[model samples]
Target: MSGDFDTIRDASSSDEVQLVRLLEEKIKSLQIEIENLRKELNYYKAEMEKMLSPPLIEAVVLDVLPDGRVLVRSSSGPNLVVNVASHIDQKLIKPGVSVALNQRGSTILEVLPQKEDPIVKTMEIVEKPNVTYSEIGGLEEQIKELREVVELPLKKPEIFREIGVEPPKGVLLYGPPGTGKTMLAKAVATESNAVFIHVVASEFAQKFVGEGARIVRELFEMAKRKAPSIIFIDEIDAIGAKRIDIGTSGEREIQRTLMQLLAELDGFNPLDNVKIIAATNRIDILDPALLRPGRFDRIIEVPLPDFRGRTEIFNIYLKKMKIEDNINLELLSQLSEGFSGADIKNVCVEAAYMAIRDGRNKVTMKDLVDAITKINVKRNNMESMKERREKYS
Candidate 1:
C-alpha cells in the first residue's frame, strides 16, 4: 500500500510538470500575438490621424496687424483676420507674400515661397522652333518691321535708352488666316533668344469665375520674373473683343480677362524686359482700348501674298522638291492667284502626294495643276457651306 501511494504521487508530479510547460508555451505565444496586435493598432491610429487632418488652402498676405493678427485674403474665399501659428517665422509675414491657410481659412498655417504659378510654368516654350526668317517668303517688309519693333528692342536695349524712348511695348499682327502671322511670331521668338510663352487668347476664357483674370495676372507676373520674355497671344480677338453689358457668364469672364490683360499691357508696373506679340484675323472687332498707343505700339497687317510674293513663295517651297524639267514655277505662281504662302506650301505638298500616288519619283506641272484644282474645289466647298449656314441662321 505504501509503494502504491508513492507511485501515484510520482505520476501526479510528472503530469503537473507537463501541464506547467504547456501553459508556459501558451503564454509566450499569447505575448507575441499581443505585441503584433499593438503594432497593428499603432498603424491604424496613424492612418486615422492623417485621414482626419484638414487640407490647406492658398492665401495672400494683405497686411500684418499690430496685435499679432494677420490680414489675409483667401484665394478662393473672401478676406479674413487670422492668427499666425507659432512655428512660422514672424519676419516672413508681409504683404504680397503667398501663404497656406487652415481648413477654415482663419489661421495662417505657413508662408509659401514665391514660385512661378503652375499655369505660367506650363506655357513656357523650352524648345526653339525650326521655322526661321529665311523659310518665310513674301513678308520681307513685315518681317523687317517685326524685327525693328520686337527683335531690335531685345537685341539692343541701349539704342532705345540712348534715343530717349521706351522700346515698343508690343506688336500686333493682324491678317487673314494662313498668312504667316504665327510663323513671323515664331521667327521673332527664335531670333531674340528670349523666353517664349505662347498662349491662345481663348485659353484665358476659363469656365470658373475669376480664373481667367487670375491666369492673366499670373501670366504677366511670370513674364516679369522671366525678364527678356516674349508672350505671343494668338487669336487676340477672342479676349480683345469689345465689351457689352448684355452678356452671359462666359462673356463676363472674357471681359474680365481682357480688363486684366489691358492693365498688364500698360499697367503701372513697367514691363521692363518683357515684350508682347498678338495675332488676329479680325482686327476690326478689337476693342478701341487695345488698339491705343501705349499697349500695342505697332499694329502691322499681314496680307495675302501678291504676284511677286507668290513667285518668291513658290521658289522657296519648291527648292527641295524633285521636279520635272518642264515644271514652270513662274506659271505656277501666276496660277496660284489669291493663294497665301500657306496655301502655296499645301499645293506643293499635294503635288508631291499626287506624284507618289502615281508611283513616280518626280513632280510634274500637271500634278501641280491638279493639286491646285483640288485645293480650290475644297475652298469653294467650304465657302458655300459657310454661306449656307449664315443664310439659314
Candidate 2:
C-alpha cells in the first residue's frame, strides 16, 4: 500500500510541472502579439494625421509644360487642379493656367498671425523713385563721393577694375541727430537706379523669431540678384544692438537674427553691383563687429553744415517757396546757426505763415526774422500763435 501511494504522488507532481510550463509559453506568445499590434497602431495614426492636416501653400508659381499643358505648383505638394470659372486672363498673369491648393485641417496656419495676400507681392516689386539727387541741395562733396561709390558699380564696372579700387561694400553715414544721412542714402538709390530696401530697427524688433533673420537673408539675396541695388538700414543701432546675455528666449532669437545678418552680409560678394548703406545717429551704441573693416568701414561724418553749405541748402529750398526780393537767404543762413537741414526746412515753412498773416504773396526778410525769433523764444510766448491756429480751426 505504501509503494502504490508513492507512485501516485510522483505522477501528480509531474503533471503540475507540465501545466505551469504551458501557461508560461502562452503568456510569452500574447506579449509578442501585443507589441506587434501597438507598432501597427502607431503607424496608422501617423498616416491619419498626414491625411487630416497638410502643409501650407508656400507659393503659387506658373509652369508651362513642354506639351503645352499649363501647370501650377501650389507648394503644398498637392496635385495641380484648376477651376475654370475662378481664373483670370491677363498679359502678366495668365489664369486657366492658374491652380490653387485646398488647405484643410491645417494646424500650422493657425499659428501664423494672418493670411498673406498674394496680390500685395506684385505691388512690392514695382520700382518707384522717391527723391532724386536734384531735389537735395548742399553737401556736394558728400553726394559726389557717394555717387562714385554707388554709381560706378552700375555705370562703369570696367573702370572700377582698372583702378584696382573695389567699389566700397558699404558706406556708414554717421552724424549728429537730424543731419542729411537719410537724404544721402536716398540720393544714392536715385542716382544708381537700383532697388532700394529700407529697414529701420523698429521693424526688426516687431518681427517674430526666425522671421527677422529670414527677412534679412531674403533682402540681401534680393539685393545681390538684382545687382546695382542698395539696401539702406536706417538707425542700425536699433537692430544691431550689442549682444548681451541670452538669458531669455527673446534675447536668444535676437542674437540668432544678428548672427544671421552678419553671416549674410559677410558671405555676399556683389557680382560687383550691389552696395549696402547704413546710417546711425548714435554710432557709439552699435555692435563692434558691425563696424569692422568689411561692414560700414567708411564712416563718413555728416557734421553740421558750414556757412557755405547752409547757404546752398537755403537757396535750394527757397527755389520752390514764394520769396520776396528782400528775403536775403545768406543772412538767414548766418542767423540760423547750430541748426540742422531739417531745422532750416521747418524755418522756411514757419516763415510762410508770417507771409500769409501779412496778406502778402511772397515771404520777406522780416517774415523770416520773426519766424526765427518765434522759434527761439520760449513756447510760453506763442499763446497768440496757438490761439490764432485754434481760432481758425
By lDDT, who's the top model here?
1
lDDT of 1 by residue, 1-393 (tens): 999999999999999999999999999999999999999999999999999998898987756789989987788878899999999999888766789999988788888888766665667463455568998888999999988888888888878878877766888999989999988888887888777778887766743356888888877766654557788899889999786663687887788888898987876222256789999998998988998888876899999998888888888888889998897877888888988888889999999999999999999999999998888888789889989999999
Candidate 2: pairs in clash: none
For residues 1-393, write the lDDT of model 2, one tens digit per residue. 999999999899999999999999999999999999999999999999988875545333233345433344455565453322223332222311223334541211211222333321222331444777776666777888887777667677788778666666778888876668888887777777877767675466564554667667556645554556677878777677786667987767677767877886676553356678888887887888887776667777788877887777778788889887787878988887777787677778888988898788898888887776766563435557879898999
Best prediction by TM-score: 1
Please identify model 1 stretches exceeding 4 Å from their true place: 1-127, 206-210, 268-271
The per-residue C-alpha lDDT of model 2 at residue 240 equals 77
Candidate 1: what lDDT?
0.83
| TM-score between model 1 and native | 0.72
* TM-scores for every predicted model: 0.72, 0.63
Cα lDDT, all candidates:
0.83, 0.67
RMSD of 1: 6.7
